[model samples]
Target: MIVRPRPNWFRMLFVWRGSVLPVILPQLIGTTAFAILVTVLHGRVFAWKIPLNFVPFSLIGLTLAIFLGFRNSTSYARYWEARTLWGTLLNETRALVRQALTLADAPSDVPTLTARLIAFVHALRHQLRTTDAKADLERLLAPQDCARVQAARYKPAMLLLMAGEWLADRRRAGQVPPALVQAMEVPLGRLTEALGGCERIAGTPIPFTYSVIIHRTIYLYCVLLPFGLVDAIGPMTPVIVAFIAYTFFALEALSAEIEEPFGTEPNDLALDAMSAMIEATLREMMGEAQPQQPSGLPPGGFIQS
Candidate 1:
């Protein structure tokens, strides 16, 4: 995600780093060229003139804008949910580490336990992004523990299971009282729920047919738009059509970018930064010094959303 102070109104118009303009620029240019061609042709096909008018385009534009709005809302819902899950992860991991430090009878084991927790956070991010977690796991876990988690197909779930086992071992050995063990399990269970939620979002995507229909509709509407407006606006068709096409094209592109929320896209959640944050927060709780870096989100406007 692009993280910086919001620019002033005039500069915002020219800002490109976090906007969908970069991805849709080609589409916008192509549509504008098509508009220019249609305007020059006077909306003609060889010897015959295409019968198209502004009234139908005006009506269609309104409905198409509404559909685009609805689709964007749906995509934003997924993006927001994914962020909420990660936020829960940060909170629960902090809570669990605090509990382990104060409640566990064996103080020396706290650091090791914290390492496993950190590893789990990194593992979840890698799992969601479909990246390798071997380096992170090796850094945070022992040879045996790392090997065990690496061998599992689902690294995050495997790490979560190990955490539950850690709590169980402490309870059985009389190092952690039964009541305290039950209390610690609350955060662990919340962590598990967050894990499950991330998995659900990663595995499920917006319906393919729905996206296809909307995408097809937007392009079709834009392509035929100039033909309808050339007679009404004359030479101004390309300019008007370019502006209108930009709106529709940008919206569709933005929706598609955020629909999967776990990607490496500019709008996707800052998983790498967030994972580092969890690590830094946990280390601080364990009396380790860590300098936290900023991983701020973009503005809430639809253009950036």
Candidate 2:
């Protein structure tokens, strides 16, 4: 994700890094050229006039805009829900660790719990992004624990199970009170719930047929728009068509990019940064040195802005 200060409105017009304009630039150019051709021909096809006017185009454009708006809205909802899940994860992990850290510090339960918590965060992130979690699991987990989690198909769930078993052992050893164990288990349960939510979002996507129909409709609308507008807008059809195409194309591109919020796209959720933050903060809580992230990982926990 591209994080930076919000530019002034005047500068925002040309800001490129975080915008979808670049992604849709090719489509915009093609539509603009096609519009220019239609304009030059005066909505004609070598002496055959294409009978078109703004009437039909107006109705179609309105309907297309509505569809685009609804689609983008749905995509953004997914994006926001994903962010909320991560935020919930950070909170739950912190609560779990905090509860453990306050307990009997003699038997070293804090480190085990903290490692599992952090591992759960990374595992969920990797699973959502469909990336290998071996490096992260090894870096954060003990040999046996890492091996066990690696062997499991669902790593996050495995980590949570390990943590639960750890708590059960703590209670069995009489080091932690039953009441405290039950309280600490709350966060773990919440973590499991959040995991299910993330999995649901990742597994389910915008309907394929809806996406295909909307995609085809948007492009077709843009292509046919020039014919209808050239008859009325005359020489200005290219500019008008380009502007309109830019709007539709940009929205569609943005919707697609953010629809899979767990992706590594520029507009997708900043899972790496977020995971780094969760790890760093938890390490601080456990009094561990803030070590450098492993190779191929981003350095800072904070997203600069």
Candidate 3:
């Protein structure tokens, strides 16, 4: 995600980083040019003066704005929900690792379990982003576990299964009380639920038909708006159309960027930074030095991944 200090109102108008203006600039320019052409023609085609006026456009623009608002709300809901799931995952992992350390009779196994939990976070990050997690798994997991996880189709789920098995083994050996085991299982179940939630958001997107309709409507309105206004507004038609086009096009572009919160887009969630945070917290709990920073993340916690 784009992390920087917020600028004042005056500077905010020109701020480019994390803004969708870059993506929609071309569309805005095209709309402006179309508007200019329509203005030059004065709503005439083949010597025919089309009896168009701004009244119809006013109604269409109002309705289009409402639809765009709804679309943006839907996209932001997905983004916010993804962030909430990750937050829950963070809390659950911390709780599970803490329980394993304090409650287990075989405290020696705490380090290994904590390492697996860390590995699970990285694996889940990679899974949601559709990237390879073999290197991360190898670094954070034992050779046997790492190899097994690498071979599995769903590495995160496999890691969770291993965690459950570890707890089960302890229960069988009478190393931990049944009550403690049950408590530990609670966080594990929560972790599973968070994973499923992320998967659901990643796998399913806002319906394509909504995007198609909104896209068509926004462009159609922008392209035809000049003809409606040229007679009334004269030479200023392109300028007015471009201003209006910016608002509609920018919102559309922004909604597209944030709809998939796991993506590498600048405005998407900072999964790499979050994974690093989980690692740091777990390592601290284990009384170990902080792990080296991951490649994509820079110093001072600016996440580009």
* Candidate 2 lDDT by residue in tens digits, 1-305: 87666688899989888899889999999999999998888888889998988898889888888888899999999989988889889899999888887765444768988999899999999999889999999999999999999999999999999999988888888888988988988888999999999999999999988789889998999999988888677999999998889888888899999999999888888788788889988998988887565344444433443
Top lDDT model = 3
Q: Of 2 and 3, which scores higher on lDDT?
A: 3
Cα lDDT, all candidates: 0.87, 0.87, 0.89
Clashes of each: 0, 0, 0
User: Per-residue lDDT of 122-197 in model 3, one digit per residue for the tens?
Assistant: 9999999999998898889889999999999988999999989888988999888999998999999999999899
Provide TM-scores for the models. Answer: 0.94, 0.94, 0.94
Off by over 4 Å in 2: 105-107, 291-305
Error of 1 at 181 (Å): 1.0
lDDT of 3 at 151: 91
| Model 3, backbone clash pairs (residues 3+ apart or across chains), number | 0
What would you estimate as the lDDT of candidate 2?
0.87
Clash count for candidate 2 is 0
Stretches off by above 4 angstroms in model 1 are: 291-305
- Point out where model 3 deviates above 4 Å: 292-305
**TM-score, model 2 to reference:** 0.94
Error of 1 at 124 (Å): 0.7
